[model samples]
Target chain A: MFFDEFKSWQKELTHYSFEQVSQGDVERALGHERLDFMDFLALLSPAAKLYLEPMAQKAHRLTLQNFGKSILLFTPLYLANFCSNQCVYCSYNIKNKILRRKLSLAEVEVEGKAIAEKGLQHLLLLTGESRQASSPEYIADCTRILRPYFASLGIEVYPLETQEYRELYAAGIDTLTIYQEVYDEDIYASVHLAGPKRIHRYRLEAPERACEAGFSGVTIGALLGLGEWRKEAFFTGLHASYLQKTYPDVEIVVSAPRMRPHAGSYKPQYPITDAELVQILLAYRLFMPRGGITLSTRESAPMRDALLPLGITKLSAGSLTSVGGYAESTETGSAQFEVSDERSVEEVVAMLRSKGYQPVFCDWVNLRDRRGA
Target chain B: MQQVNCELLNDPFEIGGQKLRSRLFTGTGKFSSHELVPQIIEASGTQVVTMALRRLDWRNPQENILNYIPKGITLLPNTSGARTAEEAIRIARLAKAAGCGNWIKIEVIQDQRYLLPDNPETLIAAEQLVKEGFVVLPYMSPDLGTARRLESVGAAAVMPLGAPIGSNRGLQTRELIRILIEEISLPIIVDAGIGRPSEAAEALEMGAAAVLVNTAIATADQPLEMAHAFRLAVEAGRSAYLAGLGARRDQAEASSPLTGFLREE
Candidate 1:
């Protein structure tokens, strides 16, 4: 499991200072012939700031060579906003005065058809972290309903047991996306005031459980502004690398979601700059050439467009972050976060084409993962 | 045995009911720009071009990769990232469903360090694809047993790697491939790791039916020129094989009796 790898690295990096990382180490990492973890660390170091241009160049070439000039696009459909946890940085915090809503089964079919009409073949279903509000059977039913419309289905809901994940896979969910809101235990505990999301270890191992349950793909990340930026990025890389190396066949994607404005006014403790996010993304591409790098809709349109050449393979386009957001329903759930890139799916497709990128809707057929769908 | 003639050398190279004019097969990966793709295909004179299935976007027909490849080229859509037989079969079905040709290259790579093709999964995939009326060419390690099995399962051709894919190592498994050539009834198309024109020539001269050159041509500084060079080398090597290479001997067989003149024996 990644927990052992995560704990050991977390303890070891405690005494090690980023200031000690020299320019020479960063250069050696840049010039390394094959990708390795040590080289990734050097690239992520502070001294690598001067080598960002070279790192970006290498990352671009590597990404193009491994994955062609195609950017996969998938939109998130926020199923429900009801949460048992009090994640202070999120808009879905129960303490916040937000209109929490869950889509009925008929509304789900409507939303699925609405997205399907836009020619999207892949859909990511997301929900708040509350079993009482959204149970496993409820999510599975949603998966079954969405299966007929989309060629593939992914989930970003609360973590579940291996059996639950297996049941979802059988129900047409082949991919799992989970973000351990923060990696630092102390900061994690402070932010997640209540509920099962407080268990950081379980959240971290959710991707592993999904893998063990035979999911074909897993996207794992850490919300950037919650803790020390560099350490969180490193832990996220280590976590992703562990899963990648263990499940070589499974598609591993790394996403770096920055803190966007939400319902609550929670300021970031360690706000990372835009250039730092680029460095993190480039380092990820260099480390795992085959593993995917996804750019979320939390960033501005210009920011996402500018970072495309620096090793981004997956993108979220025309995303609606509220429950029943796509359908013409009177009851609209509050958004988990504000949308920064409001370009419609057509605009996103045109932008990708103008930038010489073919926007892909479905990557995997996922025939093995789906049984009776 | 009868002597090889020019007419025999000019005979059609047919595999799975398709007659290929060029013995060199090119790929669309590793190129810096898609604009260079047509040039490389033209320079290489390849009739079949391989590409990954994940690179295509069926929804956006205008930005399709098919636009980049010129007409009359057979596309060999590969299952590059598929890890199991089911995944490979699914990709094949999707390709067929999308109106892409039925020709499929089954690559089931399990290891990341070497990118070694898993022979078991490949056989499973090939068997199912062939049954489904799709022409299947499975990339595999050059083993006589596996080659024979592939032939028995109606594989169009058995593509054995010369070395690890994209390693630029060149013909590390020549002896094994030579055995496959001698034993298997199917065509022995050497794929991957022939990084230079001379290595491609060597593969053909050793009796490989055709050579698939991708990285050696795509990654070259003068990719088009390299493609032309590989085309000429593959043609020369195929001609040399038809003309028959000379047998080898440990001791030197002096031409013009140089030993008698120098040693005064």
Candidate 2:
């Protein structure tokens, strides 16, 4: 007999006891002296789009009120590109005959030192799914080796076990970013055809496991164009809310990444407009004012600049989207995706300074120092 | 005529599971050097100091200042910049994780220019934190009504501002503070707007359980001398209040009450 699934989308959607909010609620929350979580939902509603200017103003005021005249800057270094999964939309898919490379320990050290020399403190480690080459042990070893070199070190790689996260924690890995790609299970399963990435449930459970393993922060997001943007947006906020409440100590960051042009032959079926992306970002901020909202290099300079003070708190400047691109950008042959902002680190810092933002080059928190052992 | 047997302040004034003896609370911002900060704070006799949350400066040898303060002084991490309840909640969580003490000075001020306390936001944050088992001492405007409401919500103390924070304008609401003294039974710490020894003395005289003066002492040309002056002023005020101040007469009166008593025979 074929296994009949008892749970369905309808059941899962219905089971969500989220406090539903309307546009009016958002207006009330913004107008009121105190904003609650429900008010966050109201601000993100379709009706709240008309009030974008005011919302942006309120977000700016709050940002200044909380963070003061400062903007934190960090850069992501794509360490390796060796995948086992057939991710249809990704540039680093195993099926894609593009040059695949993995950074050696020395190479990672070289890139890390190069980035660190640029007065960069916060470093994000990126890689594709390659259990053999980029295993948890390898990542942990890299993290341990790179701990003293940077102030804050985070990872964006394949999901691992909770015990694996504990091992990484021991290795001084401070933060983890595991994008669900799409929260819709069917879309996720369809998009990821082979390898451990095919398991939709496991990827969804990775952040939770990482949190359980005592990670300081867990960032959640869905690729904007992969599934129904509205549904994905709602679920992304819901998931962040869940993690925030469940792990109050864990800093929650919500990143909105749309499918940008890449070397992959495939393209997005549903494209997200820049306006819609801004709306989604606004909604996320209105929903969770305290949560960290990040803007990556996937966006154009104008968009990144316009959105910096509005709600986005973190930015990745002069990011390299290919393995070993830091030491030698040309050696990578091709980048995973074309960078919308092509400004160099120095240029970016100068621009940020001219714009009245204190472009920080280093991570503020030392993961190694945080570890008692 | 008398040699005063002055008593140095006590520590750990028994609130919740801890005792906070030194009532003076200081902040790290507006200071020129971190090295001089510990010295100034130590000289101020502040057993508990407040610090705001900031992104870690990973490159600095001493990124976290919490580690630098004298180990005995309790660190009361504050949500000074939060404009709303949610932001305050977020800062509080980060502070707890950073091990800056569970006691949070919940300050949710929306107006950056004025730095006025948003009472509604503060109450909301206090309610949530107190529920979450945090010792909340919210910095509020000196509105007696608000202080009473805050005390009812399990606030360890109601920190009513003598004036807008960092103003150094001194206590501008003496009448209202007198009312607050008459009203709430909780520890009424006069926080902010206290610029000099006289203001500190006045707050103590008004029956404020404690007074938190930062800018007046920290920014003084002679921080140590100013700190000592404030100590004496607080002591004088407390003693005066305890010894029973003479009643003020609205109208001129005879040496004795003319209406109620006959002339001494």
Best-fitting candidate, measured by TM-score? 1
Determine the iRMS, in angstroms, of model 1. Answer: 26.9
Query: Which pairs clash in model 1?
Result: none
* Candidate 1 lDDT tens digits, B142-257: 98777777888899999999999999999999899987886576889999999999999999888888989899998898999999999999988888866545423223322332
**Chain A TM-score for each of the predictions:** 0.98, 0.89
In terms of lDDT, the poorest run of 10 residues in model 2 chain B is: B256-265
Q: What is the C-alpha RMSD of each candidate to the true structure, in Å?
A: 22.0, 22.5
Candidate 1 lDDT over A120-159, as tens digits, reads 8889999988899999999999988888788889999999
lDDT (10s digit) by residue, model 2, range A12-121: 55654333545555556666433444455456566666666666666666677766656677888776788888988888888888878877788778888888888888
Question: Lowest-scoring 10 consecutive residues by lDDT in candidate 2 chain A?
Answer: A1-10
lDDT of 1 at A280: 87
Q: List candidate 1 stretches off by more than 4 Å.
A: A368-373, B1-265
Error of 1 at B261 (Å): 76
True interface contacts reproduced, per candidate: 0.00, 0.00
TM-score, cand. 2 vs. native: 0.56
Interface RMSD of each: 26.9, 29.9
Error of 1 at A182 (Å): 1.3
